[model samples]
Target: MKKSLLIIALAISIISCNKETQTTEAAAFKTAYIDTSKLMEEYTEAKDVAAKYKSKSDEAARKLEVQEANFKSDANYFQKNAQANGQAWAQQKGAELQQRQQQLQYAAQTMAQQLQEGHAVEMDTLVKSVKKFIKDYGKEKGYDYVYGTGDAASVLYAKDSYDITDEVVKLLNDKYTTSAKKEETTETKKEEKK
Candidate 1:
């Protein structure tokens, strides 16, 4: 009976050890990270969005430049004719020019404000979309954790194998290409109908 009791105790210990190992193995996490700056630079949608905004900003700059040139021209004309126009007329014209300058400055400020707001909105939307995509990807890939590392790094260290930045960027680009193609096809169809 003493021998049997010792054997049973040993058996229980062995089984408990096996269960502990299994639990530890099951708890091991599958983790990955993406470089966010790389994603922003390489992702097709992000690049396209940035380019669109840049073009808009450039156009706005051009408009402002034209307004500035006109203002400068008017100022030059005022300076050349101010003496001939005499003090009273020169003062009245100067006031008008000053008002015009203020209006131009206001217009430029408003445009800059609008552009800044628009860029912020676009950035917010892009970030939200990227986050949703990453979440979905983590679920599909059975990743326990998917971190982002960039200038502001959320992940400090990850093996190259666990760095999925390229894969994520490629996947995002492919999706963007497919969507763009679909839009192009739709547009072509609409034009043909017209």
Candidate 2:
């Protein structure tokens, strides 16, 4: 009876140890990280957005440049004819030129402010979209933690095997391309219907 009791106790202890090992294995977390800078650099949507904004900025600058050139020309002409045009005429023209300058300055400031606001909003949306994508990706891939590494590195060290930047970039670009193609096809169908 004593030997039998000891054997039963040993069996119970072994079963408990097996259960703990299984629990430990199941509790292990899967972690990965992405290089944010590389992701942004390689992301087609990001590149396209950047180019679009740059074009808008360039167009605004060109319009402002033309206006400035015209203003400068008028100012030069007024200066050359100030004495010939008489004191009253000179004073009036000077005031007009000053007002025009002020208008130009206001226009420049407004354009800059508008562009900055628009770009900031667009960038914010893009960032949020990327973050959501990453979160969804982690969930889909059974990852418990997904870290971002950039100029401001949140992760101190990680193995290269854990870097998913390239994979994420490829998936993002593929999705962007597919969506773009769908949009183009939809537009073409609309045009045909019209």
Candidate 3:
């Protein structure tokens, strides 16, 4: 009876110890968070993409300005000559001006739509790229969870030690620079071959 009781006690202690170790392991699971706003601001690829779109937007704006000037010129000409041209001629010129105005409006709308769509697509790609990099970084570093905190930070507070924003930004920028270099090299090689 005594031997059986001792064995049961020993088994119980071992089971308890195992459970305690499991809890400790669970507590040790690594987690970190990144400042997403900082990441976006510092990420080279994101800046490059923004600059690219800004140039496109600027070009569109210039085209619209030119169109606007032309439309204004046409309107001024019609205003000056409408009285001398007679009702029939003035009506035809007014109709032509109206059509040109509509065409300019349509062109402006189309450019705006294209710019919006391009921005959406570029932003989407940038978001995906950032997410993928973070995911891979977390996995590589054995992180159980890598949280993101930004303007609308879900994480109220976190230890500075847990913030990996700088590391992530550096990694992303280095990758961008390396890829850009490779592209330039390829272009040079192609030019040499030509």
Candidate 4:
């Protein structure tokens, strides 16, 4: 009877110890908050990318306007020259203009596609760079979890000390700078080759 009681007591003690350890572990777990809005606002690469695409789109619009004017002028010219070829001449000029317009439309569509594709590439690259930085940052800091405060999700309550936003922002900026330098170097080399 005494031995059985002792065994039961020991088991209870062990269970109690385990519970305490788990509670301590849970309490010690750290949560870090990252402000993605601030990072995005300060991000240079994103701005640069936007500017590039905006300029390209503007150029496309100007080219389209010029093309429209040329088309109108060509149509007028064809109308004036229709008397020379008699009946079929009008149809021939219209057909030629139609073919040329179709070709221009195809080219414009292709340019728009390329612009979209370029934007996608830039976004993917930027996102990948951020994820990579996060991975490295987490590893280096021994972070239990880093909570991203994207625009949709509000961080209602986070301790100022636990905010890793600045650290992450720095890492993102550094990565962007490195990649930009590499791209510039590559462009310079290509230009030299040309």
Model 4 local distance difference test score: 0.84
Pairs with backbone N, CA or C atoms under 3 Å apart (clashes), candidate 3: none
Q: Give the TM-scores of the predictions, in the order they appear.
A: 0.86, 0.86, 0.87, 0.71
User: Between which residue pairs do clashes occur in model 4?
Assistant: none
Q: What lDDT does candidate 1 reach at residue 75?
A: 96
Candidate 4 lDDT, 1-194, residue by residue in tens? 99999999999999999999999999898678888777777777877888899999999989987987898899889888888878787888889999988978987899899999998999788778777778778878888887778685567778888888887777777887998899999999999999
Cα lDDT of model 1 by residue, 1-194, tens digit: 99999999999999999999999987798889999999999988888778888888899999989989999999999999999989998999899999999999999899889888898898899889989999999999999999999988988887889899999888888887998999999999999999
What C-alpha lDDT values do all the predictions have?
0.91, 0.95, 0.94, 0.84
For candidate 3, write residues 29-103 as lDDT tens digits: 999999999999999999998899899999999989998998999899999999999999999999999999999
Top lDDT hit: 2
Identify the runs in model 4 with alpha carbons over 4 angstroms from their true place: 1-20, 79-85, 151-162, 178-194
Measured with C-alpha atoms, the lDDT of residue 44 in candidate 4 is 79
Best by TM-score: 3
Worst 10-residue lDDT window, candidate 1: 44-53
Sum up the clashes in candidate 1: 0
Q: Write the residue-wise lDDT of candidate 2 on 69-134 in tens digits.
A: 999999999999999989999999999999999999999999989989998898889889889999
Which of the predicted structures, 1 or 2, would earn the higher lDDT when compared with the native? 2
